[model samples]
Target chain A: MSNLMTNYYEAAAVILFGIGFMNLLLAKNLIKKFIGLNIMDTAVYLFLAAKGYITARAAPIIAQGTAARVEDYINPVPSGLVLTGIVVSVSVTAFSLALVQRLYKHYGSLDLDEIMKKAKKEEKV
Target chain B: MTAVNYIQNIPFFSIFLAIFGGIVTPVLGNGKTAQKVNLVIVTVIGILSAVLLVHLWQREESFTFMMGRFPAPWGNELRAGPLEALLALCFCLVMALTLTGGSRFLQKDVLPGKQNLYFTMIYLLLGSMLTLIYTNDIFTAYVFLEINTIAFCAIIMAKGSGESIVATLHYLVICLLGSGLFLIGISLLYSITGHLLMENIQQAILDLVQTGEYAFVFAVVIGMIIIGISVKSAVFPFHFMLVSAHSVATPASSGILSGLVLKSFIFLNIKMFYCVFTIDLIRSLKITNVLFVFGLMGMVVGSISALKERRIKHMLAYSSAAQIGYIYMGLGLGNHEGMVAACFHILAHAITKAMLCICAGGLIEASEGNVGINSLRGAGHRNLVAGIGFTVGGLSMIGIPLTAGFISKLYFATATIYSPQKMVITLLTLAISMILNAMYFIPSAIAIWSPVDKKAKIPKPSRAMQYAIGIFIVLNVVLGIYYAPIIDMIEIGIQLLES
Candidate 1:
């Protein structure tokens, strides 16, 4: 059952990645693309978290008054890495959103095509 | 090991001070006082870092420091090997110079109350870069990388121009993709290796490769790592974002971006390749050949783009891309001499590029933003010191004899001759591209030095501007001539890699 769950998680990750890449390529809306990116990031976090799992194991944290048993504990490294990854993704998301707001103000349109056209026209002038 | 231990407990107090000082600058003072206080603190940190680096150089020790007395292979570790120390030294010196070099421009148009925020970002950028280089854990490195990226975005936004905003957004989009790819790659590595420690993972990979048990997985893992780093370094196929982003940033920000930020990525790449992947695996994977091809292409294409560009900053940005190619090409050679040449070029390019950008900033300010090559015609006589800075920096970029750039290029070219692949022919062809560099750069140099046009009426910058230009010019010339000490230090760093 645990192996089946792990397999499902892996498939979900791959599907999310595919969807993200598609949106990145197909979508014209800047914010939509950012949303796709966030989705993809979430998929990666899930995948990493799943990889650290151990069948019939408890959480990495040691219970009070109980001696630590390494054999029954899930690997903590990937979880730690995922935590850092989540923080990094959040930071990127915040900064990119700020940049998007600025872009909206500058080009007066969030459409990438319109902004490029306007920029090119200004350059020519 | 004995030498390592003696130096291990010295403590990286100076680095901590610099980082803490940067984090607190915004909270401690008002706008006017913040800039002065930050500058003083950064300068002190720079001096202390240099002194520590000198001591380390003299002692010839390299070791990792575990934070809060945590043991390595588990807890967070700050590795201060010779290479890390050398890079830290370079960062401190460049930060000091850029702060001093850009003060005049900062003072001229006191942007009505963003001074404290600006210095705060600068400090954070420096601190992040130091941490990025010093950390051993890949995840910790990512944390610092995020800090660096956010700080850079903030710096770009601080300029508050419509163009800067657009460029910053573009940069953010591209960087997010790159960082996303990077995180995915790290996750895959973690899943496979089950060890967060780089050295242990390297050993595991080496053992597996030797046993031939997981060849396919090994290839995929290595490919992911290379692709991730390539994006960060803004190598070919991923360089579209850098040109506009660097060009639109403020001159001081451009200096930091080009001189230090990109160098941080390159630093991480070197660590990822040399420290995390053994030499045999790298060679067997034919990654070096791929690097050579890309490097050569960047050298040619970047120079061509620079030649065609009309805007001064855009041209400089493209030139930076070309210079990055040179550094990578040296790395691809994968020899001691190649490593030395690459390290030397990093220092030379940082100083020269920063000086050039600062001078361009002064010119733009003096002319009230009318600074195309055509508009710059005959402005040289108006501001001779700025003109001299441009000429000196331009000469170095072109790799003229007696300049630091010359030695780096020459050494790299010689290394190509020694390469088994007979890269000498390619080096010769790339050297010819320097002619294209001269064609684009010389006109600007001449415009800076030629008699002022009666029609243009460009004004001279203030004494502060003159002093800034003078400092960079002196740096370019003095470093160019007296580069032996630096060369010696770099050689020691190369030896550390070999060990």
Candidate 2:
């Protein structure tokens, strides 16, 4: 239990992911589902960044005259990956929001259930 | 660089051409120019991919092209084996054919001003698909996967109808969730190995397998990636969104979406499994068993439901789901023969389904855009060429001995021979699915041919559309009769792919 407590960052990230995934599935409102999607994306990014960080480690950059070793700096790859992920998540959010706007226009509601009903009605014709 | 040297870089060059096309096509911004530009672009790309295929085959070894000066695990890279080249070649040709064949539908469906945007989206979608095929970097693959999803959604939206918007929203949410899961899987794998290059990642995974450490996390990652891909590829349970998306999309978009786009996700998974996880690890993990059950279920479920669909396009969409089940069945069998069948089915189904969707669209056009199967009565008589095209495509789907579908089915049957435990179930499921496939397909094919009150003056598909369909029909026959070279190529390609 104590060992798990020491890794709370990861636990938190995983929890956020679980919550986001649940929200995405359970949320009736399109906007909330979209929020859930972003939350999930954000959670993954957090996990990735957390994986790259180490206690007492300096930034990846090396100063001109400093004697440096590999362990002195945290691994930089995951940070770079996390940045890319963030950009991807941002675009996804933008795209979904645009979609939500379209949905709002077409169905006259943000409620997925109502929207689905409209879609079903439309399909019959 | 010398001209020959330039030709040697065809893989990279073709990718560049597609990206250039995506950027340039939109700027041209009109129907005439977009069509002209698109023609030039697709033709050039088709020629390039074919040339690349020949070049790679002749070389007879995998070519690893480094994207920068940085070494493995750092710099980006692209690898070309016979398999990748052949897929790119097929993708280019099918994409071009679908676009050309569906141009009339595209023009009619999309707003006049936004047609250029539609063309732009198409080029970008092709560009992204090609990127996914060639990229050896896992991170690059993910990036391109996002780009591919966005561009595909954009193509659907260019229709600018309420139904398409709803359909695109449904499609996007599903795809984003799938991709998100995939990204998390990638991130987990990266954290474990500290590597993003496919080669390095494979090496790290091999180490884990050898040591038998981190087994639980490994299994979880595997599951995540598989589920993610299953959603993207519309494997069995995750396929509810697919019929809606396809039914609402334009003919060309639907053809490309159902036929080729979905298969690329399967390709990515194949690459991941073959390139990273050894077959031993896969079997030990029992991933194959899971796939086997779901695939069998899909085969039964998809086809049975396809029988109930009233709309022509929707019925075809459901059949595609069942066909995808065949590919998964091949994957689940978990052997070289099974993998080959899956790969071959990808090619066969792409050709058959694209042809079917295009022909269905033409039939609907002949019916004055009535989508219901009732509207299809005597549609064949009115538009003889489309009727013939649809028949040819349908016959191929039925797995007739001389057609491509038979080759896939034959391969699947033979593949079942190796997996003794799965043999009975595989054969049983396959036989039942064929009957189910025939149940839905034969009735619809007959229904379309049966005469009804003739609605006259239904315009036939234009000259170009006819030629494209004719070419596709011929291609299906050629693939069926002369399958030796392709199978051999796949074998050689699979070997090189298994790094």
Candidate 3:
């Protein structure tokens, strides 16, 4: 129980991840699906951020006029990784949105099932 | 500088050259010009990596080059061993051939204005695959996985049809889910091991294993990584996206996606098994057992699905899933020979499937865009080269003697001899899959060759395409015949990988 409490952030993040994954899977609207994807990405970011943070530790920036020590700061790797993740997620979301926009333009529907029906009809013709 | 010093730069050069080609491609403005540039770039990389393979084989050693001045486990790194170089060489070779072979379709299928952009994506795709092959950092692999996914999605939709567009959207969604899983897995791993470099992580994992702590977390991490990659690679149950995306795309896109892209992820898994967790650890955890079950299911189920597909391209796509199953089956055997078999199958399947896609494109062209198997009757008579190519490719797929596929199957069978526990299941699946392979491939092969009632389009595949298909056929036969040296090379490569 103490271990679970101590890692509550990770627990919350995992739950968020599961919810986002479910939404991504079950949502009919393409935009909503992408929103779910974004949520999932955010959960990942949270998990990574929590992993990188250490209680009472300073940020990774080197202090001026003081000798640098490993103990002075939290691990900066995950922070850099989080930045990379944000960039990746932004691009992915933008790309997915652009695709969804094109899909909407083509079929005039945001629902996947409707678009698929229209596409099948189009193919039959 | 000495030859060794110069050889060390080949991996770096070969990767960035493709990216450089991609960057400069849009300036060319003409799709034709961009394509010519792309071919030149792939060819150059092919030659460079081929040379690197020879150099590495002779040296019998692997080298890691640090990006900029940063050291290991921190800065980015690229490692080249015999295996990496060999796979890179083959990828470059296959990409060049695929582009050349499918250039006509590219010209016809893609929008005129987007042709240069199409070539740019191809260049980037090549760069990303090479990066995936050579990267020593796990995060670098994940980043390139996204790049690869995006580039592939763009190419799939390059055909500019509603079907292709819709297919691309689905593909993008599924691929994002995959990469999202992969990213979280990497974060979890980094949190535990505090190292992103594969070698350092392996050491940390070794210590963790020895201490017998956090075993549950460890299993979750491996499971996440494996499932993420399996999803992307279209293993069995996750193969729904492959059929649509691969079938709807242009022949070039189909060939590259089905042939090379899937194989790269599998290669990454192999690397993780060998370099990240080590084989003994993986086996001890019984992860291979789970993979083994999935492998058998994919083999049997994928082949059965292929048998039921009506469209020629869809059938080929399903067969690819089955072949992926074969590779995974070999991996799941959990022996050194099985790994080698998996690698050989990778090579064999890359060549054979790419040829099959290009040949199918040619047949479709000759038949005036009808992809139905029945409609393809006498497609052989119209485009004889494509007909012969498809026959040979199909034959290879069925494990006919004197083809690359036969050698791989033989290797897999021999590999099963080492693991008696898996022997019965492995052999039974192999036998069943082989028959299943023949059941679909034979009919399709015969259908393309059979007589048709109507007149067929006499579209001759272009000179470049003819040359590309010719080289693919020749390479297939060569590998089938002269496999000893290649297998020896792969063995040496695997040794280098482990060391």
Candidate 4:
């Protein structure tokens, strides 16, 4: 219980992940599902960023004229990873939106179930 | 250039060439030109990988190439052992052959303006697959996983139909979910171990295990990684999306997706099992039990689903799911020979399924775009080469006496001898799945060859396509006959992997 309080950020990230995951799974609207995906990605970023941060340490950048020690700063790798994750998430979101646009034009609906039914009807025809 | 000094650079060179080929393809402006370039790039990579494999075999060693100046822990690195080289070689060969054999359909199915982009996606897909096989950094693997996912969706969407687009959407969504889970898993791993390199992580994990600390977190991380990969590769239950996507994609796209992409993910899974978390640890964690149950279910349920499917491509897609079940079952057996069986099955399925998908495409073309099994009457008569190809692939899938599938099954059976607890279940599932495979495959094989009331006039596949299919048939027979050498190589590869 003390550990949970100490690592509150990670716990919050986990809760956010669960919420985003459930929304992505249960949402009927395609765009809403995509929004859920974005939220999930955000939760991951939050988790990663929180892991990279240390309470007492400074940012990875060293100040001018300062003799720097490795322990004086937070871990830089996870921060770099967060940046990469964001780039990936952004491109994926763009691609998903483009696909949604096409789907909407074709099916006249953003609802996944409706689109699926219409596709089935078209296949039958 | 001097002697064998440059052999170590082959992995790097092949990855660069594949990706660079994709980048330069659009500038070629002509689809045919881009295709020629892509084929050339793939063949070059194939030759280079083959050379590297031979070099590694002769020296009996593996080598790591640093991406920049930094050493292992701090730098991006690629490692090529016998197993990685073999996988790279086979992937290159499969990609080249898929393109060659399915080019006719590619040209017909994809738009004139979009053909070049399609090849670009293929090149990118090949590059990412090779990276996934060779990468020493788990994070590098994750990055390439995204590339692979996007490229697969692109190729599937290249079919440019309402149905194909819908299929792509579903595939993309599921793949994103898989990668999202995988990313979070990686983040947790990094947070715990503070290293992204596989060897370093393994070292940290070993120490942590000795101390008996963070066991729950460790188990959750491993579970997330396995489940993430399984979902992406469409192991049963999560396999519903695969049927629609593979069936709706073009022939080459389906072949690549089913044959190479899924196998690469499985290979990555194998790597994680061996390199990151030792098999003993995984067994102790009881993750193998979960995999075992899923594998059993997938074998029976996937085959049953395939039997129920009426469309030829849909059946083949379902069969792919069943074959995946076989690989997972082998992995779940949690023995040395079980891993060997799994690797061999990967090769068998990659070669056989690619040939099957391409042949199905040829038959569809010969039947004037009809996809139903009933409508394929006399398709064999119309396209004799495709008919023969499909027959051979089907027989291979059914574990017929002298096919690649038979060798894989033999290995699985031999592997089961080591695990007494799993023996009965493994053998029973094998038998049941084999029967189920034959029940659907044999009839479809005969139906295609069966006579029709009115003969349909259709164009034959191009010479390149026929030649590609012919080569696959020969490779299948050869693999079946020469199983001893390949099995030995796999054993050596596994030893190198664990070391």
Candidate 5:
């Protein structure tokens, strides 16, 4: 079972993605949802980076002779792509955190359900 | 180099001007200067895209310009056809007009010190939309997708109420989820096809279909991309967040977000379905009917919800969901005419919805920000410009003859002739939704024009806003009356897209 689990990195990345997606779907608190978003972002990056990995292949280096041999090195495009994904994820996380700070300041709660109940109560006027 | 080569640089210039506007806006230290910058940026882009449209129409050719000096496999690309040019033109005109018409509201609603930030976000949003349309690289589109999402969230939160904050958070989370799913889909595609450029990916997909071993994963990727964009566009089941987000947002932001931002994704979706995977392949997979059912559900549900809602902005927002369904219906029809109708609906809906949202702002101002349906009583009488704009927009939405909305529905009606069985369903959906459209819009139109509370409370709009609304009214009428050339352009554009 352990061998099967570790045999495929793509399966691990996909499972992580499923967990993150489920968290995003079911979480009630705004902060928890933010965490869910971060988790999902990381899972995607993991999946993207895994696409570059090749068994028994060296890192993508162009040291003279082996640079001519395509099979000697892993694909570098996915690694390059992972960098871009990480940057986008960082910006989103920062902005969402700023928004959560303001939400907390206004409602005195981070839970969407509680805040909604209070907001509705306040709107009764 | 020939002059055509320089003329081909319009898309690049349009994108860079917007990026430059975004950077310089905050440093200008005031909203007034920032507004001028926004206007100037959009105007120049609009003119340039219009010029490019004429050139492309005359030449009947598409062009792709490589970024940097990198060789074919490594270089990024900007590709444009008549359709891309026309969309860029519409987006710029609508953004400029909405900004002009809603400037006063922007000054009033936004915190005084943060107005420059608002303009900054607006510019960034425009830049991202243009990039999304012109990008030939898949990764470039995803990066711009995230940028547009963040910029839109900022504009919504620029209103700064508790409700606005909550709305922004909700929209942000949803966007994150959608984009995450989209990223997974792109990775799967790249892994399978080993290509990121759209044309290469298309060829790879064609070859993959021939081999037929990875069919399940291919279908999953297709579903993921469609669902991802559907979430972004607020198609049917994902529409619950749209009403709150659009309504809580300031009127100008609401206008731009609902009008242009959502359409950008739909345009991308059409490109994906048409360019990335030919409609024939999509049809073979039998996903066309699924889109039709979802579109039908959206039309029915969105209109009925609007019929029950009383707030004018919420009603308008719900109507947007329904209008998006109309575009989807066109897409799901699975013919060239259906694609044309969908694209036409994109333009018509953008102009009408922006005009309506901006005019709604005027009505709210006249009523001292009372958003209730009845409070709009005599709002038209009070603010004559708001009254006229609202009536014209409403009529167009309800599909009156000689309006752009009616033409789109007419094209859609003809487009439905492709499938004899679905013809009845298509027409029935249009007729019922139009009635539902009238049920909500007519009442509000009457409420605005009714004579009970005719006293003018809100001051006359600023000169700029008045000019903006005036231009919008003329533009809508022109789009309706002079639609033949536009239709021809879409035909040529679709031809370019097809090949």
Candidate 6:
């Protein structure tokens, strides 16, 4: 039964990776690509969390008036790292979105091809 | 956790001050006030870094600081051995030079209202890079990497041009993907090891290898990590993003990105390969051969691209890519001599590339952005100081004798000789590339110095710009002549890595 859960989580992570990779390859809009990247990041976090889970383990938290028991609790380290990873991913996504907004303002278009053409014309002029 | 010991560790304090100064620059400066505050903050941070370096030099042993007093296995730590100290010192010194050299280009190119934003981003970039080299936690390194990427995007936006904005967006996408890969790799390792501490992870991997249960997984994770780092460092195929990004960003931003930001990733690569992964693991996986091949490809492709570039900045950007390939080749050799050569080249390239980028900026400003090679005609007959600086920097790039570049290249070449396959290919390729470098650089050099248009008036740089360029030139020549001290310092650093 534990192996089943692990397999399910692994499949989910792979699906997420696929979606992210596809979006990255196919999406031309910068914002959409970033969304794809976030999805991919979530996939990795899930993989890590799954890797740390064990059979018959409780959440990595101490009960009221009780000391922690390592044998009965899930590993908490990956979760902590995932928290940091989420923060970094969100920061990068926010900054990229901000940059996209700036690019739209400057070029008056969200299309990558249009922007490149416009820049080329400016270079010639 | 132990009580905070902030007063005892000067290097940590200095780094914090530099980062805080960066965060506060936007709040403290506006309009003319911004320039004054930027000058003061940068100067103070520069001096603080210098003092920290001097203190570090006087110490006889390596130092380690645990963040929040977490034990080695559970908490993140910062280690400042000789190598880390030397790299920190290099960053500080380059920051000082770039900040000073940047003023002229910033005043001319940056949108007036965004001056504070520009300086703030520069500070953030420096802070994150310094933090990256100092941190012992893989997760913390990832955080700093993200910070550097975001700050870099903001700096690109400061150019306030359509191309700059588009290029920045592309850079953002690639960096996000790269960081994602890095996180995946780190998470995989953390899950397997149950520890986030770098030293713990190293031991955990070794234990697993001993058990022989997860050797393939370990190799895969290591490959993912290297791939992620290569993307960040803009190696080979991952380099497409950098050319547009660096060439289109403001000249000052380009200087910082090429001179220091990429070098930070290279530093992390060295730490991960040499310190985190043992020699047995590296050899068993045959990773060195893969890296050597990719490095060779980057050197050739980068040179070819650079040779074809018509714009001055584009050429310099491509050249930066090629030079990075050289550093990787040195590291890929994976011997004592190779490691030493890589360390030396890092310093040499930082100084030389910064100088070239600054000179390019000055030339662009003087010509009102007519920076094509053909347009540089008769520039030398005009501004002798800037022209001479550009020539000296160009010669260094070509690995001419009596320059810093030549010293590093010689070491790398000698080290490659230990492996016959590498030596033959590297020597011949580098020889051919040097010729290619001259093919592109010589024309520009001649055009700049030639008296094609004698009557044209040459614009002299301000006192500040002159001082900045003068400092770089003197250091380049001085460092080239007295390279023994630097090599000895790097040897000490390599020893620390081995320990």
Error of 2 at B96 (Å): 0.6
Q: Judge the docking of candidate 3 as incorrect, acceptable, medium or high.
A: medium
Candidate 5 chain B has its poorest 10 consecutive residues by lDDT at B453-462
User: Candidate 5's residue-wise lDDT over B1-499, tens digit each?
Assistant: 9989898788888899998999998899989888998898899999999999999998988898888888456778888999999999999999999988899889988988999999989989999999989988888889999999999999998878888888887788778778887888898899988888888889989998988868988889988887888788888888877888988888888889889999999998888887787788888886677888888889989999999999999999999999989999888888899999999999999999999999999999889889998988988887788789889999889899878898998999999888777899999999999999999999999888878733554687667767777888888888888999999999999999889
**What's the TM-score of every candidate structure?**
0.93, 0.97, 0.98, 0.99, 0.97, 0.94
What is the C-alpha lDDT profile of model 3 across B315-396, one tens digit per residue? Answer: 9999999999999999999999999999999999999999999999999888888988888888988888889999999999
- Each candidate's interface RMSD (Å, one decimal) is 1.9, 1.2, 0.9, 0.9, 1.1, 1.7
lDDT of 2: 0.86
lDDT of 2 by residue, A19-119 (tens): 88777767999999989988888888889888999999988998999888998999898889988888887887899899899889888999988999998
* CA error at residue B455 for candidate 2, angstroms: 4.8
For A13-125, candidate 6 gives per-residue lDDT tens digits of 86897799678656877667777887898898898778877878898888799987779898787777778778877777777777778777877877777777888898678
Query: Can you tell me which runs of candidate 3 are displaced by over 4 Å?
Result: B452-454
lDDT of 6 by residue, B1-499 (tens): 3322432365566568767877777786564566667666656655655555555555535566877866888877877666776777777777677767777677767888788877778778877887887787888888888999898888877877877777787777777677777877887777678777677778888888888977787888888887788788988877877888888876667877888888999999888886677655775787777777777788888889988988888899888888888888887776778878988988888988888888887776666568788887776655565677789888888888888988988898889877676788888877887887788888889878776644655467767667777888888887788998778777876777656
Superposed by TM-score, candidate 2 places the C-alpha of residue A38 at a distance from the truth, in angstroms, of: 1.0
Quote the B-chain TM-score, candidate 6. Answer: 0.95
Q: How would you encode candidate 4's per-residue C-alpha lDDT over B48-137 as one tens digit per residue?
A: 999988888767788788899999889999888888898899999998998999888888889879999998899889999999999999
Instruction: List candidate 4 segments past 4 Å from native.
Output: B1-4
lDDT of 4: 0.90
lDDT (0 to 1) per candidate: 0.75, 0.86, 0.91, 0.90, 0.88, 0.78
DockQ of 3: 0.76
Q: Could you tell me which 10 consecutive residues in candidate 2 chain B have the lowest summed lDDT?
A: B1-10
Clashing pairs in 4: none
Candidate 1: residue pairs that collide? B380-B448
Question: Judged by lDDT relative to the true structure, which candidate is superior, 1 or 3?
Answer: 3
Q: State the TM-score, rounded to 2 decimals, of chain A in model 5.
A: 0.83
Which 10 consecutive positions of candidate 3 chain B have the poorest summed lDDT?
B452-461
lDDT of 1 by residue, B179-269 (tens): 6667777777777776666776787777877788768867776776676666767776566667877777777778878888888888887
